[model samples]
Target: MSHDVDVLALENQVCFALAVASRSVIALYRPVLDPLGLTHPQYLVMLALWQQEPRSVKDLGAALQLEPATLSPLLKRLEASGLVDRRRSAADERRLDVTLTDAGRNLRSTAESIPQTMIEQLGMPIPELQALQSALTAIIAAATRTSELTGEASDE
Candidate 1:
């Protein structure tokens, strides 16, 4: 047996674990967000809008680490759902602004419990989850910095 055997193990791959964990966690939100007419990505967009509205598409893309092409469709879907309005900015006709509609603002109340429900379903203590979040944030920052240095910001 080689000394690098452990390093080459599938279970030891961070990307593999992260990918599976992300998919699994997102799946947990499926049933919960279905009633709200949101997919996990759409739900994330709503969360950002709930925090601050009238943001430009560029701003949302940057905040969500999403590419413009990827975010455009999600915004269109949200607009069609009556949860948001996508309009040309009055100040800048070239820019698209995303704002919550009355329905979108009202949906906030219903979404308020989703996080807690997700936590309960995961059955993890809040402190542990918080720590996990912190670690993930650090990983993201490191990856972002690496990408900046390498000129390879997230391919997607």
Candidate 2:
């Protein structure tokens, strides 16, 4: 082992960097999401739904890497806001189906500019942002695969 390598330093810890960046970037979305009546987590849920509606809670939880316990409350709030509806799936009574409401569908138009706004706010180029997102997605996939092999993914 080389004495030049300081493994204990915070700067050298990828987990620490990822954790800090995640918190900071989510924080940046707070102001941007507030006007749309969404928390960052809620916005993420909406994004998923906007892409594909009438999905099961389980499906959503999987896609968002969230748990039913954490997702149920958010769904309730979105429902209360008149943006979504939760119903029993037609084929399966046990599964809860979540679908966007008319209001929710309409909100997509308003949200179209949000991405550009955030990029402009960050003063970051679109290509750079795309690259960063790709890198993060890769990291998440690698972590998930490793976790699955180790049986830690059972929590998901």
Candidate 3:
């Protein structure tokens, strides 16, 4: 009974810890991203674009693990910011392609420092951070598999 009670404690809950940690870590990005005129989600979109331009919305959504409905508004905002241009694919009119504009491409040079800045701010060594990322990825995969097995819908 004591074990069960202790297990039920909020502090012992993985979900609670993850939720708090996620919020806290994202908060750290605000000051850094504000100067870049990006929200965390917007920054993620730009990161993907910086890696490869002319990505289809479907591909971007998959790469970002976001649904089309969620990705659409982000893309729209980026387009409005003149950081990206969305147009129909020439090979497939039904497909929309997102390409970084010149300004967006230029912004990458400035954004390059963000990773080092974040590392310094976090005060964690690269190896530790990489391990944490690996663990988190495994957790995500396990949670996804559980959701699938149980037929539960997950936005993530």
TM value for model 1: 0.96
Give per-residue CA lDDT, model 2, range 49-119, as digits (tens).
99999999999999999988999999999999999999998899999999999999998998888888888
* Candidate topping lDDT: 1
Instruction: Show the lowest summed lDDT stretch of 10 residues, model 3.
Output: 1-10
Full-model lDDT, candidate 3: 0.93
lDDT of 3 by residue, 91-126 (tens): 999999999999999999999999999999999999
lDDT sort, best first? 1, 3, 2
Model 2 earns a TM-score of: 0.93
User: Model 2: runs farther than 4 Å from truth?
Assistant: 154-156
Clashing pairs in 1: none
Worst 10 residues of 1 by lDDT: 1-10
Clashes of each: 0, 0, 0
Q: Give the per-residue lDDT digits (tens) of candidate 1, residues 60-134.
A: 999999999899999999999999999999999999999999999999999999999999999999999999999
Model 2 poorest ten-residue lDDT run = 147-156
